[model samples]
Target: MDWQKNLLIAAIIAVLFMLVIRWNDFQESLPAANAPVSSAQQTDFNASSDAATAGDIPSLPGTTQAVPVANSTSTNVIKVVTDSLVIEIDPQGGDIVHVALPRHYDALNTPDVPFVLLDNRDHHTYVAQSGLIGANGTDSAAGRPLFTSAQTEYRLADGENQLNVDLVFQQGQTTITKRFVFTRNEYLVNVDYLIDNRSDSVWSGNLYGQIKRDSQSFHKVSALEMNPFLGAAITTNDENYKKLTFKDLNESEFRTVKQGGWVAMVQHYFVSAWVPDANQENNYHLRRIGNQDIYLLGFTGPRVEVAAGSTGSLSTSFYAGPKDTERLAEISRYLDLTVDYGWLWWIAKPLFWLLKFIHSFVNNWGLAIIGLTLVVKAVFFHLSATSYRSMARMRKLAPKLADLKERYGDDRQKMSQEMMKLYKTEKVNPLGGCLPILVQMPVFLALYWTLMESVELRHSPFFLWITDLSVKDPYFVLPLIMGLTMWLQMKLNPTPPDPMQARIMQLMPVVFTFLFLWFPAGLVLYWVTNNTLGILQQWYITRQIEKADTTA
Candidate 1:
């Protein structure tokens, strides 16, 4: 019975882990929509020529535009350095060509190369582009405006909290000021379009912010690890977070009008989002560029009228950085949803709060995880105690059950009836331990995701040899120890009479150890701590049961 219960638990966990790993495959196999983009759609987003007129611009808003002004490796990049970020802005389309986090390294050991989020490299193209798109606007024509910047390089000065990089586009008396405002220690940058209508009665146009990216994975994961989602997501009136895949873009164009919302490109650990004015009515759209794997997620704001001899402005903040839940929440509503914890967010949120609180005192993330696990176990102590007591009673009835089995021989029905009689006489519930473990599965899964998705745990050190909690242990120590404790827990329960069940019970720990060897060290730590606690409680309960039997 004990062997069967342990086998079942092991099987359930393995199935769940595999299901999560294959989730993306399931999504990719879904059928495409009827109106998939044709070759004609690719021409709509073709690269604009240098000599271009307004006719080249598409009538539809939020259309994907090729980077026609400059190609990758061109000497036309404007680099700006802030306290927390290194950015490269291209004047051709006034696009953010490159963004790197100076505070975070690309890998655990590589301290020199920062994590590059957005770049215009030959192999990859992920840039944030924004400009005016109407009468007298910068990008109103098919040809992107080649604005001139005052300086090619700018760095945040000492004690400076704000920096501005202004690209000026002037045609006679009409001037369009494309200003990029960056703040110290913040990832949000203000992209503003200032329209100075000097020789006009009323200049009418719309401002657009878009992120263009090729289908490329930012981080390459191992076989056992699940790749983070790489696609577009938007917040709408009905749904808090709606994921728009590349396939979805190819199938058909999507447009939604909302008073306040956001459009974003998400990846593992990091996200880049456009948060517009909450009171402004904006149209959000997604589309694919022809057969090329290029996709765009963007927003077009309401038309603005810049009166004669007056200056008008439309602005939105672009957040490009790590998916810090607190920081993203401060930027916009439901923005923290980018740090996806799956359908278990309700449990993961509180679990994160507890882990964060514990880390405040312990000053070590590994210790904080251990502390949180202990607290969770303590909260369910009584329920677990009842389960252990029932198991102990069952173990005490093993001799009688064995006698019934011998008497019934091949008669399975009579054996089951005798076993039920003995169970009723002793008031022992066979499924008590299993029910308690099942109840705790959601908590376990939530905590697992919390450990996996938390960027704070990335490259964090625990103790000797456990340098990075976000990655697998180099020596596979924690997982091996976890396997040992699981085996010890099995030993505390009554041995199964069935040889096949006993063999399965003997092998489950080994199977789990192999699976966990590639798992993150932080997750393995949580499991190891949990299994050790369970073994201690079960050992104590078994001792108490034997003492009672000897007294009787």
Candidate 2:
């Protein structure tokens, strides 16, 4: 294909890819979620804290709670943290509070508190239930059948609740130990699995690690405000972001998606869990928080056929943390490649890289986003110059192109051919303006994903009102600037001969402005900065080229 056609195809391909992805998003809304809730269950949860009454609290997810630790203090040994991740492990149950964000919040404005209680440490979730892991809901949505039973075994002699958090299953001949470790600040959550096969003959079966229940915090609103975006979309019993998918092995009956693979379930949020292969072929299931169709995202590694009287062990990690951009870039090549977010990275990453540079200066993510924006404007002054010049040159050449067309009459092919010849004779690259615009696309996308998917950007702020860059622009200031910059850019560029097309193009700034109002502030900032740079570039190019032509 001609370079121009190829460029056009590339642009169209990028746009189409974006559209198809959005459609695919609707086609597969997060996997089937648990049942919303029963009227009776809602009534019970609303009554009061189970601290006052026994049996009032729901049971933990899978196993019946073990006998409550005899010591009262140890029952709530987990100290609530406000500044950072603090893990307090004693024999009794543990409390895991990601006190990173605010404890109190308005569901609409503020992001949810980021915390996943493996088992409600203090049983606030399952009030009065002292022993055995209880189920969150009657159905599959409450979370997979997770059996979390704790005993204050005498091994580690700290007498808190005398609790040892152990999630395992033991039958006569086979024992499965899936959960045994404590907390993780970053990277991965390690799980130790010991399978003992005591049968006289060889015993072979596939072990499994299934996500029974994953949850999201919701705003307890009145019956008036019940939307799925808020609450309406969930099932009767399962309301949070939860899913149940099988271990991905050689399950041919199930269709597998190639793009996301095993990590499909994880995006900006954190998710890592480990389980041994459970050969219960029928046990593969996939579920999400709001949808109803079950789909599986799992891995079935090697098959197991163990001889009699032998023990086997499997080790795995559960990653339930934020997705850091640079850290993930190094984590795997797939992660780095997937960072293609959109055009914003052309502006955001340099800001991040510069901030990382000055993070050498003053290590704060908030400051870095600010600093990054500043450095981007400085480095690309020349491109901005050329971009503006090209646009202005087109402006200068438009009247000529129009006169040539008018003289040529309605013969479009002849006129276009003449126009090209004239442009060449006059040393004008009719298509010179497109290259810079196209090259910036991938860089912009990469930064977009970096900002959206990175945990470092999560909860980080750039002053008041512009708190979270990951969510929609709060005050609309950034989006407005973006629109204004585009208008300025258009003012500097050559106008299309078709007045109607020009009018439509004139409206593009506003359309894009409104579209971006829902986008994160950081993204809008990048775009505004980029457009401003392009105008400067085009202006510079026009002046330089004109000078040489006049001298010639």
Candidate 3:
């Protein structure tokens, strides 16, 4: 009779689950809204140009082989190759036109083609641009200097650990030499402007660094999918990390004053940032560039006055690479915040640290996730022990509880009273299993986000069949195993007196299995490991309680 009741309840819940799934599918089938429209930037660069009286200062040259007004033809590109990076610079304004990471690829299976971080081709305008602005500077309202380099190609030779690409622009008696210094195994490039004020008059100006990007997603995401942030981020005096969306920049401009901070454009797994000298006061700005979908995040350095016949250099570091928190933290304060662990950062950070430590020894990310789950289970062992023991005691008294319920079958109020009295006398809590789960839910969610968002696990593989931990299990093996363990854990607990409650319990494993089928394999592996461990502990405690009861 109880089995009949359970079957009825299961059937009803299954119908409800099907309805929910259908509703989600229907919603996803709908058309998406239009993309954010472009708008013109409303900046006061003209006023600044007028005040500095450097309106004749040269603006940056176009990197996409844009025709110049002077010749309407010539274009120059300088190529630089290093151990880990390949970059292209346009001498027109000394802008970094293209950057590709040799160690990373464009896709999971594409090894020959490297991952490109910056480019100015195929209608995609993403590049790093910087130059001195204000008085006596090359960047001005009038024009931008087109620099001349000795060669068009340079490479980091064998046995060499550093390389320098220099471009120079001479205007009247003043000479501006822009040097881009690259190290063998580093993504941070030293972009320095050495201004030789050979002229009798003093030279004065400010340096500006900016990242310009259009509104095209580098990695395509579905409309109903949950995607990582793709926008502008800045470190401020008030907050460690602040995000300004492309839509936000389009609506209004953003400006702030900070002595030390960074302005960056962040995407799914990579970021490009302009980190100024910490000792200098800089003004940070975020705005959409003139009626296009392009947006700019940049900083203006403090005004500098170089004495006549003296050379003064203004330098800043630009990092364009993967979001490796450990390396980013060394570059600037709060730069690691770009990793973005969400509101659960406190829990996620420690979990990631422990996970990484485990991987150091095991040398496998999948095993590291299992080790992490075991550690979390051990930490909550005492609370879980208490909860499981309570449930075990209740399970031991299930026959008596069933007898009581049968005696008061027609009297609902009286049955409840008797159940409470029985729970008090036996010192058993029917709801004990819920509290520990509630306590650990946040930790579980944190670990999920940690695994899903960490780029280190982007294409990491485990044992057979699990190729990418950051995406779903290819054959649904892990999720099915997780569901099986969950069902076993349920078997060790007392059966619910209510047919509806029992039915819901039975359906939970199936529901969870369906939901986790799309979750990352790493996350599902954690769940399966945790559930298996819990089942073992609960089964052991249940057996011990039954033995003691029989002996007593």
Clashes of 2: 77
Candidate 3: Cα lDDT at 446: 80
Task: Supply the TM-score for candidate 2.
Answer: 0.59
Error of model 2, residue 454, in angstroms: 1.8
Compared with the true structure, the alpha-carbon lDDT of candidate 2 equals 0.44
Off by over 4 Å in 1: 1-74
lDDT (0 to 1) per candidate? 0.79, 0.44, 0.79
**Every model: Cα RMSD to truth:** 5.7, 10.7, 7.3
Per-prediction TM-score to the true structure, in the order listed: 0.90, 0.59, 0.85
Scored by TM-score, the top model is: 1
lDDT of 3 by residue, 147-207 (tens): 9999999999999999988999997888889999999899999999998998899899888
**What shift in Å separates residue 116 of candidate 1 from its native position after superposition?**
0.3
Residue-level lDDT of model 2, residues 57-106, one tens digit each, is 12222334222212232342333232222233222322222222232222
Residue-wise lDDT of candidate 1 within 379-471, one digit each (tens)?
988888888888778677768777876888588667767777877888887777667877887888888788888989988999999999998
Q: List the residue pairs that clash in candidate 3.
A: 40-291, 58-138, 58-143, 58-144, 59-143, 59-144
User: Poorest 10 consecutive residues of model 2 by lDDT?
Assistant: 227-236
* Per-model tally of clashing residue pairs: 1, 77, 6
